[model samples]
Target: MIAVGRIFRIQQELDCVALYFDRFESFSSTQVTSQVGLSYDSRISRLQWTDFAEAIPKLCCKTLADIPLIDDSAYVRELLQHAVMDDLLGPANGPNELIKDMSVRDRYLVGKLAPRETLDEGNDWGNSAVDEAEDVVPDDLEVKAKPAPPTAGKRTKGGEQPKDDEALGKGEPETSDEIDVSKNQSLVPSSFGITFCVDGEAERIEVEARWGRYERIHDHGITKTRKNKNKKTGKEEEIEVKVWQRIPCGGKMVLDLKQGPVSRRSPD
Candidate 1:
């Protein structure tokens, strides 16, 4: 059964890597023909295989003769070491960067392991990795699925439950269980509140608790907009977005739009 499990997992991993290679090939072809928005060079082939190299050892475990099936941490360290060696020989900076250039999973793992250093490093990542990293979406994109207008109201036995439409119109706070914290910055605010838009304009207001500081971040949401121009007509239009904010929140309050009209969208 254990052997069966290992084979199954290995098969799945290979299948995923094979699919990735196929996609990269397709993307490469599109680049050559200018059909795709982005272009990828032949070097992308190397980055794609790097992920498979890390997985193979783990999947084979004791079956492989060269390396033992140590803990995941040990395996990851070994993989990083080998990757670094390969990059150094090829005139690249290090293996860690190349590993991150491989796939999202590898990138995230590398991100976690690498020390918090200067993000704006002046190095030639050969355009391919730079484009790859830029194209990669952060894990937090999943958090955007949260409902907008982060209203955090508690339920009561005797009182009426608020309706969703009413909440949307009222610009209520979103309820969330995840606490928002930055690995590099301090998010501790003196006050808390919800943010939204009006007449295609965005605004944020403080929700001063009548009681005290609500340190608990229940949930949050956000709305975004983008501008696009017509290729043929050269006309521009604003596209509005209502995304669920993944940030941490503790309380809710009724928005006092009478405070002022939103002149423009404010960054949080």
Candidate 2:
């Protein structure tokens, strides 16, 4: 059976922790008999661990604490200390026998080990999967503006009224009502500058005229009154009339990553 031991190191400067695994042969009857005739391989398989340590400096950590706070009883920091001391002492005839003996039984119980070729192929597949999962946007990407609403009371190029036969059959002509409302509503002019935080600094952007539009709105005050004669009583009565007025409202601006900041002035 083969046993695996995990080692972890917290890199405070990079705010990242690195974990590595060391594999050694377990002291089973089969392993003992096989080792008697096998030659000792002194070269250590620390390539993956060395690569991980090299990558630690470039990692970013956003956690509140420099080191993770976990239960010390489970990790047993003394084991790591002893392992380091043993490595510094000298190379053994083979992998550390004590460490191999203490390996978790379940992981190697199946007696099947992953081949180095399979692991390398799996790493390539993993890298490709990560690339596919990433959301990549092009620098020159442009946002398509929404199509403008058809102008009220405006004819098409052929001077024909746009018809909705389905709506017309229901006695609800859409174009006329929309045109009347658009023409009756009042619009106010407004403009404002937008502020944003760029690279931890406040950036103020001016509003551009094209992106702005006048908003139609109604106010509380009475704008006018009307007198009407009752058909049945033949009496004239004064009635309060509600009026739609256009007021000046601030314009809209869009923040585009590809184009930086974009501003549009409200239409007059």
Candidate 3:
């Protein structure tokens, strides 16, 4: 009797969630693992950690319009993080439904991974932003506007501003020299980009990194016991329980030796 009573007492203090019907609960990160979910994107197959880097090339791909840049690391991270099915919001205090309800499994898998990388080129661009900016500082360390080419008379030495130099534009403080120039760029913009692409393995590694023993996302969710109607007992009682849930998943895991945490050498 003492041992049984002690067990109950201990459980009463630990966190647990009430599994109520009709409540769309957030997926239990504690219950989830890398062993479940979908991978390979076979449209029929699912994995806990999908290897999109390996899968995209097998499918026919096409480029639509090109963005001047993917922006930067934060932008890419945002694009990956928010690529989910839906919010499926409920009453303010109620559970969120869209979180785990992957009606469209394919979208869910790809959206979960965004299946992209931390490219060497992008990293170089980011580093170069800092490096190149140093070189662009004026000889005296202040960027004073060079007087506009002598108001369009016969072109004078150093006064012939190119049509593309927006520094000549009224009220513009930055000059073209201060901006980054892409190798193949024909047209220049006022701002620059510092970003690179990475490989699939790096991304996958990032997803599997521990938020905790079994928890992912923000933090571990521990619940306090609460009084509720017990279906089995048909009476009001205090109940508390912790649950870990995971769906089974499968995919071929490969490694990109040239990139990610496993790389032996980086591109020169």
Q: What RMSD, rounded to one decimal, does every model reach?
A: 24.9, 32.8, 27.1
lDDT string, candidate 2, 1-268, tens digits? 4333333432221223344333212222323312333223463433444544333323322212233444455455654664463344211111211212112121122221121222244532122111211111122222233444544476568987656543223332333211111112222111234465565343544434321111222343433323567778788755533322222223445444444554543332
Quote each prediction's TM-score: 0.18, 0.17, 0.14
Candidate 2 overall Cα lDDT vs. reference? 0.32
Report residue 145 deviation for candidate 3 (angstroms).
81
- Segments of candidate 1 deviating more than 4 angstroms: 1-108, 111-127, 130-135, 141-159, 165-268
The list of candidate 3 runs beyond 4 A from truth reads 1-213, 216-233, 243-268
The order by descending TM-score is 1, 2, 3
Pick the winner on lDDT between candidates 2 and 3: 2
Question: Model 1, range 103-186, lDDT digits (tens) per residue?
Answer: 333223321111122234442211122222223334343233344563456444667665675454454355433322212223
Q: Rate the local accuracy (lDDT) of all candidates.
A: 0.32, 0.32, 0.30
| Positional deviation of residue 130's Cα in model 3 after best superposition, in angstroms | 44
